[model samples]
Target: VFELGDSVNQIDTKNESKNKSAIELLKVPKTVKNLKDIKKRKALANLEINSLAKLKALYLSLAENC
Candidate 1:
């Protein structure tokens, strides 16, 4: 569950629509193998993919909804 303070950053809390929207904005394929960029591939290989795109989208969604 999302905490009250978390909402200030637009973190979702079991909200299907918000999750869908965030994932769509990411434009990333379901599997890491589908990733094209070498950096992304390496990150995935290391299991360290911190997608700034997705984070931005989530923040935007939160800001919009807030």
Candidate 2:
């Protein structure tokens, strides 16, 4: 026989996962002060974290271009 309390604890633990989706809102770049932020976004996109990878041979490729 399984204990109800034990099942409840397991369900709570399952909800507490390390991987969580987080979206950050960045201010519009209206001046030179936002140049660094722009560069950071580009870097992340290049790493394929905030953007989709290009398609190659009919499949999405994450390989960086030399």
Candidate 3:
């Protein structure tokens, strides 16, 4: 009975390690995708800011002329 219990425990441990590795593998791609999304959002925000700045400058020039 003790030997049987030990064998079961060893199998469970092996399965646990395999599951952990698989989970880690899955997480890596999600993490990379999240980083890519963050970078894209930052770039889009920068473009919007630049556009707003340009519009503001144009408005100021028009107001000065008027």
In candidate 2, the residue pairs with backbone N, CA or C atoms under 3 Å apart (3 or more residues apart, or in different chains) clash, namely: none
Clashes of each: 1, 0, 0
Q: Can you give the TM-score per candidate against the true fold?
A: 0.28, 0.29, 0.52
The alpha-carbon deviation from the true structure for residue 56 of candidate 1, after best TM-score superposition, in angstroms, is: 0.2
Q: What would you estimate as the lDDT of candidate 3?
A: 0.51
Which lDDT tens digits does candidate 1 get at residues 1-66? 344455433443334444454455356655555544644544443332234335546667877997
Better-scoring candidate (lDDT), 1 or 3: 3
**Per-residue lDDT for 1-66 in model 2, tens only?**
123333433433332321121122244544677767756764654444322212221121222432
Which sections of candidate 1 miss by over 4 Å? Answer: 1-50
Sort the candidates on TM-score, descending order.
3, 2, 1
What TM-score does candidate 1 reach?
0.28
**Whole-model lDDT for model 1 versus the true structure?**
0.47
Q: Write the per-residue lDDT of candidate 3 for residues 1-66, one digit (tens) a residue.
A: 112233434544544554555445445544765777656655655565455455555555766898
> What's model 3's lDDT at 48?
51
TM-score-wise, the better of 2 and 3 is 3
Q: Clashing residue pairs in candidate 3, if any?
A: none
Ranking by lDDT: 3, 1, 2
